[model samples]
Target chain A: MIPASFDYIAVKTVPEAVAELAKHGDESKLLAGGHSLIPLMKLRLSTPSFVVDIGRVKDLNYIRRTDGHIAFGALTTHHDIEFSDLVKEQLPLLASAASQIGDPQVRNRGTMGGAAAHADPSGDYPTCLLTLDAEFDVVGPNGRRVIKASDFFVGTFTSALQPDEVLTEIRVPAPPAGTRGTYLKFSRRSQDWAIVAVAAQATVKDRKFQEIRIGLTSMGGTPLRASAVEAALRGKSADADTIRKAAEKAAEGTDPPQDLNGSPDYRRHLATVLTRRALEQLTAGR
Target chain B: MRHRVAMTINGTQYEHEVEPRTLLVYYIREQAGLTGTHIGCDTSSCGACTVEMDGHSVKSCTVFAVQADGAQITTIEGLAVGSQLHPLQQAFWDEHGLQCGYCTPGMIMAAKQLLERNPKPTEQEIRLGIEGNLCRCTGYQNIVKAIETAARTMAAQAGKEVKAPAAVS
Candidate 1:
């Protein structure tokens, strides 16, 4: 399988990439890791006249600690996040989800910014980012702007990013002290996308839920927060019974797509079960 | 439009004028004359096209030739020194790791990365390490044993213990 012929533009810096995007507009597509866009191009699902290869922009491939958040360069590969000590210590949920995406070969090339920009409903990073309330730093012809996670994902396979904008960095606010998090993905196969997954990060104090945030994957057109579940569990006992009761509301407002992998009802059931397991893992031994 | 791409493959540098859409696997096989990297699934699901791109295993079928402009790639052909086989090749042969031998090159390449990161991996680790590479033959029993055998051989060659090398950036 080969993609349609297109002129390739290699950019060495973020300014150069932004300039190319401004020049080509919608006719061009920024190629970061090439893991997402290339596959679509091969299938003829996407045929861009120009491919702006940002892989040469080596500076946009870092993981750094900022003022109140950890900033990740848009080109930071999944493999780098999976193994980064800072990510493991600061945001273990992102690290855990990155480790389970596709496979080792895929992880080596897939980037967090690319995945978030692709905005697949089943993508691991979206759900984790939603739970973390990560902010995206985008550079465009008009200059730089930050988009909150809630506003970034518009729909399945869509994001709020304009065609002339490039996602430069992802800023994830550091979790509160003593906060523990876990990502539970239920897939038919190891490398397959999640059928239904859950991301939970919580802080428990005195055997009570201090703060908890839950995100569900493959439960809607876009990655969604399990608001009903979170509302039910806030300030509640961190016990198995309370978790089970709260988990029942996991799919309260979600409209999951029904496919061969599972029916909507089946997905709702999975959401409930996986939410319970994820919260239990987060609040274990509390 | 055609683009000029140059890279080091198996210790030899080759330059070619390839289309922007040409996959790295096709460039390696047709341009570089190295057919060891197989293409089982072109959609990047199968790791049969796996190759070492700058010291990391990547699906060659999914990587565009233009993306590997200045990379140092190591394919299955680059494994051995002279006529002697790499430890992984010898172990696979001894353990009967392959039946049809179609996925052998890719399996060995993927395992090369596995052992590079973790010299002594448990059986479960080996299975998870090669999760991207698929093998419909041998039931994966002997394949696990082959990786185990290769780890021990490489460890003994590097004195009593093998130290993980720094990853190439």
Candidate 2:
């Protein structure tokens, strides 16, 4: 109820949405799902003169296969992704992550692109995207640009998206054959945000770790890679001791913030515990 | 500014001009005059304002009237047919699913959605389905039992009656 008076324009096409965003610039906000934006607007935390609703753009709500990746449209609801056969088959990690997002209602109305673009530090999708090395396909008045997942997130409630750009698609590479991935989240309740979450992916070859990627959420200003752990994991034997020692380094270089749910120390502890759990789950071979 | 919205509620179609910021809960209670969908927490935490919007249960207080402009909505009042209560409503009444009756409607609506998706959910699944809905009075024990009983009744009505545990005769 605290939302101020704003122009409401529901566009039918992606180009129409992009053009409207181009015209309005900083004064307008593109609304898809509105799970994140509307709540902020209701709190009077953000005020936009125009709200260009892109939720009705059906073309931007699809899951298709691309060259080596799954092309997910920006407006694809979390519910859709959670129940998508293609996503489940191609990227079960994403499907599992999607299933654990908020609750049923929030999942029904929240969008993957919206969460990724919003880049909230504690959101679940950013961690998964970071581990998957996802690419965001953004469209603006100029054209389209594919931004790497690591570069897409800048800071709290911020992204690399330009002011006039609309995130059109999210392309997540299907994990390589024999690669395993898992997302581990710790929260007090089903609906609460993750206090700490970890997305760990690795490929094993000849009983040694061939490649490894680790993504952490709610541990820093942005979804971050466990670079120290990733470095320590390479060339190590796929054994419990090695993985545990590597995961212990998961909290390294992460200046986790303290909040009511947990202190920085607790979150750091959670990162270590969850990273170990995630790595153990992944090495268990799906 | 007020915009005209057309929607179907409980099998009746109505059109009205409403303020853009008017929440669906307000439009339902004030304009359509259906007060069964109670607004407990306007911040989208408590599902006491839960209603079926286009076949999906959503917290009405969190949704704008304009967002549901052309949708179909079903409230607690719509759950009964003539003089017969919905099986879930009857089960809740029979199983003591209410203490003050404030959270009953939302709990029933959310349980309906769960049963629709999964007709025979386990107790754990039922708990997960209604996690967004909070009921401080019932301690959640009787509420879960009521939902379980309703699911059985609904299944029986659908000709999928589950056999009760057999005695060691």
Candidate 3:
């Protein structure tokens, strides 16, 4: 699976990486953990003339507490995120999902920024990020800017990022304490991509729904929020009947594509079943 | 274009000017001539090309040699010292852990990491730990036994070190 011949530049700093991208223009690809880009290159799905390796950018591998969020360095590996105590304490939904992506080796080499920027519809982080309301930091010759998770994902294998831009950070706003969140991925094999996945977060105040967010993966071109379901559950009593009703509409507006995993209708059913299960689990932990 | 990639494999440093697309598994096998690390699947699925890179197990096929330019890698070939097999290797032989042996290197490497993290991993943990490595011949019963044996053996060694007689005090 040798990829097409390409030039590789190991960039030591974010500025250097941006400069390389600027130099190569659209021919350049910012290589982070290389788990996503290299596989694409090997399959001939992606062919870039210049691959600026940002794995050597030391400053871009951090997990820190920012003003009102936990900022994950763009190049933070899945293994790090899964094991980081801060992530476990602050965002267990994301940490648990990170633990389920591919295998230990893949998790050791895959980066959050690469996964989000690649925007694989079945990818793990996008679902968690979409539900968690994450923000992506992009830097380029023009300047640095932040893109909300909702607006960042444009379509299948596409993002709002320009070719010359580098995604430098992923900032997840800290959810309130005592929030119950869980990620449910139904896959055929341990390392297989999710056939249908769901991430749910809820905050219960006096046994009533204080906040509710649901994110679905592999349901469409982009990670889709069960907006109707969320609307139904928000501000409602944390009751089984309400959750079941909201989760019944899980597949209402999704356009899932069928692959070898299952049929579209089967996935939709799984989405409904898993959504109910996820909501139940979220509320049960309260 | 080729880039100069120098890495430490099994305590030996090797330098090569490999193409940007050259995978680390090929570099270790062809350039370094350490064929113990097998390449069963070039797509990084089988985990036959697993190797310890900078203290973490990684699928060598997916990692470009240039990406591992300065990393310290450990392959199956490095598991034995002076004809004495590593505990995991010995346990595999004792427990009949392999059938075709194609996935041994990767299985052991993955097991090494698992045991390192959880020395006394339960059977379920052992199965979950080596889920990345696939062995077609063995249904993982014996493989689980081998890891358990190795974990116990390693724990005994650690215990001996901790319980060493205090200087005749």
Candidate 4:
């Protein structure tokens, strides 16, 4: 499937990319790994007149530690994140999710920032980033600004990013010590999109849930926080019964879409089951 | 608009003026005239168009030809040196890894990467490694065996111990 003819602009630096976007305005689309955008373009779902290729921007491909966060350059591929020792140690939840995304070839070309900016409700990074409360640094014609994960995702296939802005870096705050996390994705196939997935990060102290955050994928138009479940579990005993009871609230505010993969009710049930499973696994030996 | 794209395919340099939307798979078959890489599914789901771009496996169909500027690409046609077949090709032939031979190039390319990353992979590892490449025939039993055989052959060529397939029943 060939995408519509568009003028291609390859930029070597962030400034150059920003300049091109400013020139083209909304008529341009930034190409990071091209995994998400190319497919949509081929299907004519998106037809940007100009494509700014930022895949070669060397400065925007890194994973480094900052003050209290692990900052990832927007161009860091899922393959890089899945195998990064820093990501594996600091953010196992993100690592696990990245490893499970698409397949080997897809992961080799898909980027973290691309996934987040695409804002697919079933995307793995957004769910994990939302649960981790990650922050994004974006550069535009005006200037640089930071957006929180909570506010970055506006809706399905939408983000808060302006047409002329490029996501430069993703900063995931280092979880407090003793925190354990897991991402449980229940897909029909290993490479398929999640039917309903759960991302959980928990910290237990004295057999009590000190800190618990849950993020649900494909449970709503956007990746949503299981706030009701988190609230129910916070400061509560980290027992199997308590966890199960709290997980029942996983779909409290979600507006899960129905398709051939499952119905809204089926997704709700999966959210609860997967949330419980994730919590149980995270708090197993705590 | 057309874009000037230059890349080294296999061991030869090829340059072409392609549309910005030209997929790498088509560019390889038409521009470079290497038809060994088959296109099973235009979508990224199928690995039939798999190729090694700069030492990593990627679905050529998903990658634009212009995006491969200055990249070093290895296609299935590049696997054989003159009349001698690559270890993967020989292994597939000996193990009957393919039936209709449509998915052979892609499966061999994917397996080449798997063996490069891991010289000796278990049955489960082999299965997981080639998960991207689907074969409707052979039930993947022989494909797994073929990869194991290639791994051993390659390892033995490097003077490493040819361990038996421990996970295969």
Candidate 5:
């Protein structure tokens, strides 16, 4: 499959990339990792006239902690985060999820920010970001603004990012001292996208859940928070029966899309099953 | 849409004006005249087009040539010196890691990255490391055997190198 011809422009700075995007408008697409964008281009699903290569932008590929949050530069690849000691020790959910994404070659090129911005409902990073309570920093001609992960993802293959704005960084709140997190993805192959996924996080004190958060992927048009299940689990003790009962509501309020991967009913069932596993594992492991 | 690009491939510098949409696999094969890198699925799903870019293995079909401007690239053609095959290649040959030989180049490139990061990988680790490269022949048992053999040979060679340099100087 041959992609339509396009002008390629590489920029070293965020402002320069933003200017290029503004000049080309929607005809231009920012190239980072190129995992999601290039495949779409090859299939003619997306035909941007100009490709602004922001992959080389300086100081935009790092993972560090600041102000009680882990701020990852937008260019940080899945491989980097998966192997990062900071992510391994602190955000195990992120490390685990990044490690499971699309094999080694894909992880080497795929960026966490790129995946989040692509906003694929079945994608791995969006749900992780949603569960982690991430904030996206976007820069434009006017200035820079931070958009919360919940508000940034608007629909399938869409986000709140304007055509002229460049996503510069991602900020995620650090889990509490005793909190642990886990992600469960049920993709058919190691390199394939998830049919249904669950990301569970909690801090148990004396077996009682001090804080609980669960996010579901591929159950709808966007990665969604399992709010009903989360509400039911909050303040509850971490036990097999309690977790199973709470996970029953994991698919509430979600309209799962019917596709070749799974039926809506089947996806709902997966959500319930995976949520139970995720919660049980998170509580039992550490 | 032709864009000027310059880069080092296999320790040699090359410059050309290529279309912005030209995939890196095509650039290496057509523009640079290196046919060792094979193209299986142009959609980035197949790893037959894999190559090492600046020390990381990537699917070249997914990367536009212009996007790789100013970066150093290593395709399968650059893996050996003279008539000497890379350790992985020799190991693959000895271990019968293929039936059709279509995925060998990409598989070796992927295994090179794996060994570079982890010189002595276990069998399970080698299998996990090459998950990106798909061999249609379904001869994964032999491929894993070849990688494990290569890792052992490479480690021994590295040990000899460490000893030889110190002895000579």
Candidate 6:
């Protein structure tokens, strides 16, 4: 399907991209790898007048450790994350999420920032990032500011980012020692998007749950952490009974929508099952 | 806007003016006239438009012609020498990997990427590598064999050793 005609401007610098977006407001959209936006444009869901291609801005494609956190340039491709030695070592949960994002071709072109900026509730990164307590570095005409993961996702396919702002970086706090986590997604096919996903990060000391973070994807209007379940599991011994009791609250307060993939009731059931499986895998040294 | 696109395809340089919206598959097939790069699904779902762009396999239909303006591309047509087919192409033919041949061009390109990355891939790795490229025929049994055969052939060729092709039973 041919996308609607639009002006194509390749910007070399962030300032140029910001200026173009600020001048055009809602009419302008920053183009990174175009995996998410182009598909939407082809479907006629997005018809911006100006597509400011910021892919050539080489400075925005980096993965670095800074300020006791890991900062990823929004332009970094999933391929980059899947292959990076640093990511594979220190951030295996994020790396595993990147590895499972899409088929090989989609992974080759899809960028992390593009996915995060699009803020699709069903996307894998948002749920994983929420569990990691990540922050997004937004650059706008006024200046730069950071938005926490909980506040970044406003609703389905929406974010707190203003029209004139571009998400420049994703900052994730370093995992605490003895931290182990896993992201479990259940899909009908290998390349199909997750029907339900659970990202669980846990710190176990003295065989007890020191800290637990549970994030749910495709559960509601946004990727959300299961605070109720976390609170239940906190300070409890890591065992089948405690894990099962905590995971029972996986979808206690969720308002999951019914779709062709599954019904809300089915998804609620899946959340419990997937959360239990994720916790089991993490506890088993997965 | 029209821009001069300079690219090297199959080690040959070509420069042409392409509309900003022209897709890379269109340029490869229409302008460069390499029809081997088929357009099965223009929406990038089918891997029939797969090609090696800048040493990595990508869906040409998903990338604009301008995005590849200064890149190197290798279509299925460039996978062989003057007369000899690439080992992958030969293995596919020998193993009857294709039925209708509609998805062969893409299957070969996707496998090329796999072999380039993992010269000796297991069956599971081969399946994972070409998972993006869909095939409606043969249920992927022969395609898996063809890739495994091609990997061995490629490894042998790299070591300058000639070996008889193994039969896939």
TM-score winner, 1 or 3: 1
* Ranking of candidates on lDDT, top first: 1, 4, 3, 5, 6, 2
As for candidate 5, its clashing pairs are none
lDDT scores of the candidates, listed in order: 0.92, 0.86, 0.90, 0.91, 0.90, 0.86
lDDT by residue (tens digit), candidate 4, A37-154: 9989989999999999999988888899999999999999998898887888878899889889998888889999999999999999999999999999999888899999999999
lDDT of 2 by residue, A1-286 (tens): 5577777877888789888888998999988888888788888898888888887887888889889999989988887888787777667778878888977777777889898988999998988898889999998888888899989999898999987888999999876777776788899978888999988778888778888888898998999999999999898888899989999999999999988999999999999999899888877842
Query: Candidate 3 or 4, higher DockQ?
Result: 4
Candidate 4: the clashing residue pairs are none
**Real interface contacts reproduced by model 1, as a fraction:** 0.76
> B120-150 in candidate 3: lDDT tens per residue?
8899989988988889785599999999999
Lowest summed lDDT window (length 10), candidate 3 chain A: A277-286
TM-score of each: 0.98, 0.94, 0.97, 0.96, 0.96, 0.95
Per-residue lDDT tens digits for candidate 5, residues A1-286, read: 8898888888989999999998989899999989999999999998999999998888999998999999999989999988887898788889989989998889889998899889998999999998889999999999999999989889998899999999989999998887788889998877889999998888888888989989999999988999998899889988889999999999999999999999999999999999998898888954
Model 6: what TM-score? 0.95
Tens-place lDDT digits, model 3, residues A28-92 = 88888889898899999989999899898988888999998999999899989988888888888
Which candidate model has the greater lDDT, 1 or 4?
1
Question: Relative to the unseen true structure, what is the C-alpha lDDT of residue A273 in candidate 1, on a scale of 0 to 100?
Answer: 96
Whole-model alpha-carbon lDDT for candidate 3:
0.90
Clash pairs, model 2 backbone:
none
Q: Model 4 over residues B1-169: C-alpha lDDT tens digits?
A: 7889999999899998999989999999999999999999788887999999998899999998989999999999898989999999999999989898888888999888778777788898888788888876755888889999998889989785654432110
Q: DockQ of candidate 3?
A: 0.45
> What RMSD does each model have against the real structure?
1.2, 4.2, 3.8, 3.2, 3.5, 4.0
